[model samples]
Target: DLDLSGTVGAMLRSTGGTSAPIFGFGIVDTATDVKVTLNDTNAFMVKGSVTEADLGFDNFRFGIDDNAPRMIFEDFGGTTWQLDSNGNNFRFFQAGSVKMQLASDGDLSLENNNLDNVGVIFLKQQASADADVPAYGQIWTKTATPNQLWFTPDGGVDTQLDHTGAFPTTWSDTGITGAELETLSDTSDADSLHSHSNHGASHGNTLDEAYDEGGAGAGRTITVDDGSPIELIAAGPTTKVIDILQSGGGFPELQLRPDGILFGPGGGTPQDISLTRSGNNVLALGASDKLTLDKIGATTGDVLAVQSTLKLAKPLVLDKGTSANIDGNDEISIPVVTWLYLTSAGATDNLDGIGAGTEGQVVFLTVVAGKDITLVHNGTVTAGKKLMINGEATVTLDQDHDFAIAIYDATATVWNVLVPGSGGGVGNHNILDGSVHQDSVADGVTAGSVIIGNDTPKWDELVISIPGANILNVLGIANGETVPSWKSVLDGTNPAATAATASPGTSLISAHRDHVHPIGVGTTRGDILIWNSTPVASRLVAKTAGAYVGGDGTDVVSTIPKRTIVLTAAGGKEATTAGCAAAAVVEAGTNDVDYWVLDFDKDTDEFAFWNIVMPGNYDGGTITFRVYWTAASGSGTVVWNLKGRSYADSAAIDQAYTDVGETSTDTLITAGDVHISPESAVVTLNGSPAGGEYVQIKVNRDISEDTLTADARLLAIEIEYTTDAISDAI
Candidate 1:
């Protein structure tokens, strides 16, 4: 590899000899920094140089052996300068027509120079790998003039021009002219102009002159000769005749003049001819000559005349020689003719053999029996054709009649009349006899009453007269009950033997049976009427009178009555305490009575009373009590209490002693060995407790003032009761 780092300027020269000096430079150390210079003093290198004393070499060659020869200047610090393979400065020189050259497989473009002096130049090369080639497969060329660079084919076959002339040499010659064409022609006679046939002038005639000359001898001309004969004849006695000879069995030819006249074959002579026109063109014919016999009776002389009469045997035949007489009878008679008569004839007349009547006389001709008479009138009958009747002749319809008359409208088409009556006017009444009815009687009839049997007249059957009676009253009485009355016979009888009485009272009332009576006033009361009256005065009075009343004044009590009771003591003494008191008691022989009278404010009274008494502490004392009550009927004892008390002494009661004495004093209340105890002393007063003096008494009673009570007490008293006789004897 070559590594170029610095610039160097140097020159090397080769001296000339017969062998032509050659100079070659090679890179010794490709890795060194070296730059070959052209001259030492110039500071730039030339590839090869010339010295002062010798002619230097004209060409120099340089090369390097490194893989990349361009690496020699890759690191040079200064501006880049291009170098050759030996690292020598590149140069150019030209001497006369020879020049130093450089070439490459790619483009060689010169910069900044107009290359003018060279006459012609060319470049040849194969296309590179990257080049685009056109479809025509051209080769690249570099020429100096005209197209500077182009591609062309290698051969002389230029496909761009016409190939009429000789190719290759002629194509390459730029100065060739038309005279070269004659030299290329052939000179042999067989190849000259006369050798080919002249087809252009072979058939020389034109189409118009050919057809004109060919048509000259064809048959379309007319000629006449001097020896043609002429004859004159007339169509009638005054007509003219001429003969026309037709050759070749065709119609004779005639020519028309420019003056609008026609001439026949005899030229300018008068001929027996007739003038007729076919379409708009006129034609002339010879009068006596028959061109064709269309029918057998047609002759050459049978031409028509002006006033001649033609008579046929029957109607259209000629020369049959039959005779007919139209005589004075105003009838044309022919022999044994079967004629159809179109007029009506009477029923008895024969139409076939009728005698002739006087002229203008009306005659009747009869037709055979059972044939219809057809009357044909040419003109309308003005007053209408009437079959006039004389005397009493009538036109009666024997069976069913079918009278059909044809009527017409404005367009004259006939229509039949179908009305039931006689058809009136034209077209107005097409319905003939349409309103006539065959049966003209009325539909039904009515008569008077129809009766079945006869009966004797009775009073009920006789019509009776009542004052101010109408048909409604009669109908009411007819449906009424028939009752006998006392005025008839034995019940106030009528002298008439068979009499039925009309009872006034039992008879049917007019208002009851009559429909004309007002409904509510006369008829049986309906449910609605009875229902309307039921809740009024009658029901009101019943409801009010029967309704319950409260108690009366006399049956009520004014005040509640009260009963009073007055308490009375047995000794006629009163207790100091008004209410119940413990000290109150009854005396020994007296009794206390509590009045318990019952008082009732109403009619009845009730009373209930109870009392309880407690005994005192009196040993052996007896007390007696009794309770009694008085009621309205009687009095009865209710309860009793008795008690007795024995004291220690009777005088102890009066003495002012501290203690009651025993023994002679007989102290009922004693205190023997008087021992006082601490606890309560309980003296159970059971049955009747004994009475005692100076006794501790406790009475318990659960009783109100209104309740009964008993007296119980303990007391010290002397027994002093004695009978009357015993006290006397003592």
Candidate 2:
């Protein structure tokens, strides 16, 4: 709202210091923003994190969007820099001309000074194929045939030069004739061959016979036998090596010897494997005696199909393994060993992956100690590392005695996991059935010791079976309990017979200990009580209303229900006196959820009154109130600062009240919200709260200091007090 007072112009004068603002709204802290406070020079400065600071207060955004224009930066030392949009591209301009542009597809373009071109210029000219010929004696390159250097020798026609980028052009100015080059090609190797390029190798006539390591070549042949041994290779009379090698890995190199068989690593020492060829098979050694490897079929793929059965009399060793702690990533570098012991977590260790494996290789890992391992199935993808565990079913080795078995699938570059029972994995449990693994496991606690137990984690219901009929007797004597003394006077074999020898006293002692029998003194039958023979069981039932009494037969009779008074806004009304602002009750919602809304404004203090009549069974104690409310609109912190004037009777209704009573502050995190505050701390009712009397509660929204930007719609209030009986008549 504005009133200009009918003046020809409008001007604002600062009422206080230079920092005082003349006009603004929606105040905030000064770090991110500041008001337009004018100074004596009156430069009219306002720089914030926005194009204009006034827009954000009205729910409008302040940053770059569809409404903002291009930003420009000017330098007094030289020119200007601008950031603007070029179609869908972002463009940067220097000195009113485009300098750079970035496309949306991530392509960048740098521009030159010329408006038509976008490149730099050197001393010599770089011309295109469609470009005009250069000036006299000037060297230039054509874009289409750039490798061919050209120059205007006489300022008219271009002189052709070599097309290659290598130094000293292929054609020399002191040219040799084709007839002379042909004579050099056939007859000379080093004589014309630093020489071989200008002529061919058969006396240089052909380029085909010139030899390097690239392709299969034509060569000279020499024949030699043992008696006529000739020098096959020599390196200028010095000792040198001549190697016969395959080009790369996976290609095999074979050497044939007529009389000897060698077994050794390359470049090291060679030894003879002490075996002789028997009847179409290799000689006997280890379990692989007379080992014969045969192919399955032409259609079947195999690493090496062993058609012969192999058996070993001695125990096969798995690995020379010790307990090794894995890394934080649960990774370990597994050697070519067949077994690994992964246990006793040092710091943080849980196996997730292994490294270094070959095709068809089996591995067994012992997962023990306290740390459990959850496999990251199908995940062992680190650079240069080649071990992964992939399985259709999830596996977790959680017990202290568990082992994992897997085989490397080098084709898929993943390890195919397997269950323990299918292989020779000596774990202490069975994977096929939930049975205890009775294998002798090496005890990690003591080196070289074997331990056997049922360490598998299985806890199903256990049932015991008996062989005979129902004639089993139990010696039912509890620890620290004694048998009754009068039981000794009865027939020792048949205590069930009429024991009129004298009835046993109530203080019967245990069969073993001299402790007295403990019981609670209550008479009710269905009620439960604690053991209380002076000092016994210490357990008390929580009573809400009635107390425990010794009923017939010393039974406990306790009650457990708290009496509550729930007040709704439909039962409340505004104050009827003058000079008091009151809230109006409005009905809200349909069948979904209906609330009798008592509106409390956020600017002024509004009051609502409700008078509650106590039941005759009321315990005459202090009462507490729990209020439920919702916001009308907007989201912010809300303060429910209300004090109840609980005056019953004989007091003036217009008397002054206390400054502040019960206060609760909360937030409407989701804009329109509902909240139920916890019960207010011990609000004592006025004039000795008793039966048949009324206590009037006056509630007001103390919104003079609250930040809630909207009205607070009250839903309901709960008034809770103690009760000793069920009804007023009692």
Candidate 3:
């Protein structure tokens, strides 16, 4: 080995030829084996005594291929050092260190960087596929547009997802607004799962806060928004339902079942409810169970009531009307809550048994007028055996009408009359007899004061122990005693009393004593007894004299004034004609049929009669009448044939018409002595008409006699007469 201290450089050139030196530093003997090695300076150092430099052996090197350096090492024993393969690749390995590797394809890697299996932090290339790349944990798209950090799952592909909304690492649509997302930054970790500095107060998995029973976290609620549907699916049959349980007690408040939901009072067994979807998706209840809808706050013992008024569209009738006659044997059946009105057309009817019915069945019976309806149950008034009233069945409602309202009880089988007793009477006290009574007065009688009889008696009787004032007994007259007269009870006038058996005086001087006489004179019988100033005592008087001297001392001398009786055509009369058939008389008739007598068929219109009487002491006189017996202006040739007659029986006198006068057919009777003569002989008058004389002045209208205009009406009648009697003959 040779060593150089200074720069002594010499180059030995090789001869130009095909043969050249194989190495710069080489062993000449090619067959000899050589070894070159590097060692530390402490052992392989050369130390010289004459002016030598310190030698430090640090790095080694080698060259290949045209004398280019192949591998090199630098800075031995320093912090900054490196081993370079000089544009080649190399690898280093140990059991538990980071594997430093290099590939022949010019790629480098450090294996096992304290990450999970196949999970890596990688960088993707821009615009090219990253083949066989790690896809888990953190990644960088540094060479791509808008540089971003990507978190991918294992075996990541270009399955892109956006996390700008709702949740990070979750799928979301692009262009989402911020309001749709939860803030997940460290400044405001308002999301379901986030991390912050306050680890003690913060939830690790903020989306779920679990709690045990009786713990602080119990009763905490997790609310799901409507935008998200919560679905709890069982992994297998082992986990089938979701239960909402009562806090602390562990009782299930509600259980969502695969079939239905059960929710109610939650003690032993929460109300079991199930919905069954049958064919056609119909929901049906289980057999033997009813859907009971109850009012709120209703107790188990209370009855269910309707919330509003209940009106029935039809009448609630009980048992149908009995078609069969009501016999006393068969019991009639009835239903509850109805009116059973049974009308019996039979002459008589009786009620026996009322058939079975529910409680509150009303049965009404209506009986026609004059019907006999008797209740014959005759049961005593017991709890369930009696009807309306005890023994009321014995009362026969046979009078006129009867009606009853009865109710029935199913258990009792009895018809109890709600409205008892029958009404309808004429209210006749005579028929009521002793059945009716009233509170009595002081006496034993039930009505009226003791001192009086009937309030307004039709006939009254007076019984007296002593006669009252102004009362006299005519039977008390003795043999020689005088009898009291009307003057005894009157004031300012007294008549001389006469014996009870005194006969009428024969002489006029003696008869004038107790009789009323006229002031001037009287000579006829039936002369009215009146107060006379000349002879004071009661006196006999002649009627003509009494009437002439009137009691007022005025000379009335004329007879009774004639009274014209105007009888309308409707006055009472017997006519041979059924109805009047005259033209002129019909025009003047009160009604169409009320003309006095019509002469259409003269035999049919023969006679019209009036039975009347005149006052006594009246001499026979002429009788005038309304006569429609002749033409209004005519001669005797065309006369209305009618006659007038006055009769006082057979033994007395009668005036008769013997001629048919010329002017007999006046419509309005105006003539005085135009005689409508009877068809007999004429007579003259002598004496006054007597008492007890009923004269019938009749008109005989004979339309058969003459044909002019005999349709006559006797509208009125007038009697003109005079009084004739001896003035002083009494």
**Best model per TM-score:** 2
lDDT of 2 by residue, 301-392 (tens): 33433457755565665544666566656677654455666654552244556664667767786665565555455555453233354434
Per-model lDDT? 0.25, 0.48, 0.38
- TM-score, each model? 0.10, 0.27, 0.18
Top-down lDDT ranking: 2, 3, 1
lDDT of 1 by residue, 1-730 (tens): 1223233332344334334333323332435432342321222222322332322211232233244242122112332323433223232323212122244433333434456765876545332112333433333433323322332323211111222333221122121122322223332201211111111221112223233333542222322234432222222442222223244222443323322223344434423233446633333335544333222223532333323344333333122123222222222222222212212232221111122222222221222223333222121222222222121111111111212222222232212122221121212321221222111221222242121111321112123323343322232213343532212111222222211322234433323222332222223322122212222211111122112222245322122121111222221221122322222333223354322221111111112112122222222322222222121221111111112222343423222223211111011112111111121122232232232222222112212211222221212111211111111111
Q: Which is superior by TM-score, 1 or 2?
A: 2
After superposition of all CA atoms, the RMSD between model 1 and the true structure is: 53.4
Ten contiguous residues minimizing lDDT sum, candidate 1? 189-198
479 in model 1: Cα distance from truth in Å?
87
For every candidate, C-alpha RMSD to the true structure in Å: 53.4, 40.5, 31.7
The best candidate by lDDT is 2
The clash count of every prediction, one per candidate, is 61, 22, 15
Q: Evaluate model 2: give its lDDT.
A: 0.48
The alpha-carbon lDDT assigned to residue 252 of candidate 3 equals 49
